[model samples]
Target: MERKSSSSMRLPPAVQAAALAAVGGSRLQKEFAWMSWAGTVWRLEGQSGAVYVKRAGDLKDERDRTVWLAGRLPVPEVLGLFGGFGDDWLLTRAARGVPLSDPSLGWEPSRVARRLGEILRDIHALDAAGCPFGERKLGHVLIHGDYCLPNVLVVDGRLSALIDLGLAGLGDPQDDLAAGVWTLQYNFGPGHAREFLDA
Candidate 1:
């Protein structure tokens, strides 16, 4: 299938309005990457701090989940939420530091893999009862749902926050671990599968 660049896509009117309001005087920059789901993200920076605006099809509600998880997890702060016109828009304060995708980090696969493991372990250890959205009997704690290198932020060798919480909720730990490994392989190399698993 052909992939469409985010630069070519436009946000719905309602979503655009919400993003503009959240950004205020911030400068908005379009992030040219396709979401696993039909969505696009824009980065806004200003005196307050950086913020990210995302627009997704209204198939599910990620805004509420992100807001509910704010004090409980290392995730973005929901600056605004808007729904209408068949799209859901979420504006969040940017996670401090760079995503694992930052080449300036110059981290080897092992280091990234180890960090991924550590962060995932911490996430799985959180008290699921504290999650307001509720959970399943999956025998594990909350999951990032979309645990991947790009979705994770690291600052000075420590996990700063998690992004793309649209898919997050309670589930088996293995699911997140598997997805993490898959993303590691995709971003690094096939060998990264073993390296991440070993990490």
Candidate 2:
């Protein structure tokens, strides 16, 4: 199977040149998990840190607006965005934290499960009253389309950063809670899954 290069997404001249330089016009070496249908995933290393590149994802405008609006919120920063690469390409700064899957956090399944639940709920509690980004209407919110343990990063045994906003859209907070439930089942255990879900 031949892997596709999402080079067609629109990009700023500098970003395009950087992409070309990063992949050497051959093929990118890293691929992140599935977050959406619009673009190809790749581990993009930037001057700041590891960045996940979503090419042709049609999220350039939404993401730009959302991040810009949520700047005060506890989300990753948006680095840059482009629309000339043939597809909409969005560049977001990677959040700081180890994935929740890291065994170093806690051995007890219930403990981590509860923590995950609280973290997400807290994020959803952010005041969206004056939110500048119309993501709720534009289809970008708390419930990630592909929310999973790998997409969440935990640092010092606390939820720190979240990745893969490809599915960010408007929906009930339970949507994220449900996804967290499934992730908890996979990470912690089926027994404690409901705790995270019910939270």
Candidate 3:
């Protein structure tokens, strides 16, 4: 993500205050500007640690899913969620790993594809008995609605964490598999999508 001045993307006063409080008064840097949604992601580094503050039109869904999946999966820890001024702000501790989309990670396509498939398999195997989100259709399983490479993080070639859970819920496993296939093709070129599916 490119670093940009927080001033360039004016956050609502209340959301700004909440973010500051979550990070104990740190400088906010614009990390990502979402194109698919009307949202902005900011990073804050403070004495406590690094945290991410997300501002969106609505974040309650993400917050709820993240909270529910806390112990069941590797995901960011929620710091706070605030709503005001026509926006919702979500503050979470930064996941500790590089996104697969980071070219600097130097991941081999075949191995990464296998690892992604394994991770998705584990996610699908989670018991969905008490899941409070997503429509329960036939053959539905818990899924990460957006399972693209950028959302999956890795450390030492192992899955570290998953982020951006706004679209997570009980859904067909194919939804996640299709996303993984597409991400593999996009990040590592063709010929890896089938490997990801088979692995």
Candidate 4:
């Protein structure tokens, strides 16, 4: 990831103050490579630790789902959520892992595919008895709605954390399965999709 001085970008005053308070410092770095139309992500490192701040049009859904999944699965801790300048800023402690999309990690294709399948299975197995979002239908189960490679983090070759929960909720298992297959193919090539689905 490319890091640029935070001064290059401008954040709403209230959002900037909240991020500074959460990180306990004024030093901030922006991950320009991760910026997208959906939102912009920044990293703040300080004596307290490293935290990530994401600014988007709205993040209440992500905050709510992440909080709901706290004990059930691995996810970043919600440090703070602030709203200002017609945008929502979400602050979360950095997860301890690298995204599977990082090619420099040198992960083997077959192993990565299998691991992704295992992690997705674990997510789907969670009971959704009282899940606040998504319709409670007969076959619904908890799912990582955007189960793409970048959303999954790997540490020591094992699944460590899942992020971007804005679209997560109780839903058809196929939704995650299909996304997993697509991401595996997109990242590792066509032959890995079947390995992921069959793992």
Number of the top TM-score candidate: 4
Candidate 1 per-residue lDDT over residues 1-199, each given as its tens digit: 0234446446556655555566565334556544556377666555444566677767245777777678888788776766767777677777787788677899998788888888888888887785655457748579888888888898898888888777677877888999988887877877666656665
Give the per-residue lDDT digits (tens) of candidate 3, residues 44-115: 666556777787788988999999999989999997788756678888888899888777887688878888
What is each predicted model's overall lDDT from 0 to 1?
0.72, 0.60, 0.81, 0.82
Judge candidate 1 at residue 4 and give its lDDT.
47
Candidate 4: C-alpha lDDT = 0.82
Q: Which residue pairs show backbone clashes in model 1?
A: none
Residues 1-199 of candidate 4 have per-residue lDDT tens digits of: 2335543556667666766676666666555436665577877666566778888889999999999999888999997788856688888988989888887778788878888898898888887778999878889999999898888998987878899999899899999999998888887778887778887
Error of 1 at 124 (Å): 0.3
What's the TM-score of every candidate structure?
A: 0.81, 0.65, 0.87, 0.89
Error of 2 at 46 (Å): 5.7
Stretches of candidate 1 exceeding 4 Å from the true structure: 1-35, 130-135
Number of the candidate with higher TM-score, 1 or 3: 3
- Residue-level lDDT of model 2, residues 47-152, one tens digit each, is 4346556667367654754474456444667666667555666666556787776676654777777777777776776655544433455434445445667667
* Ordering by lDDT: 4, 3, 1, 2
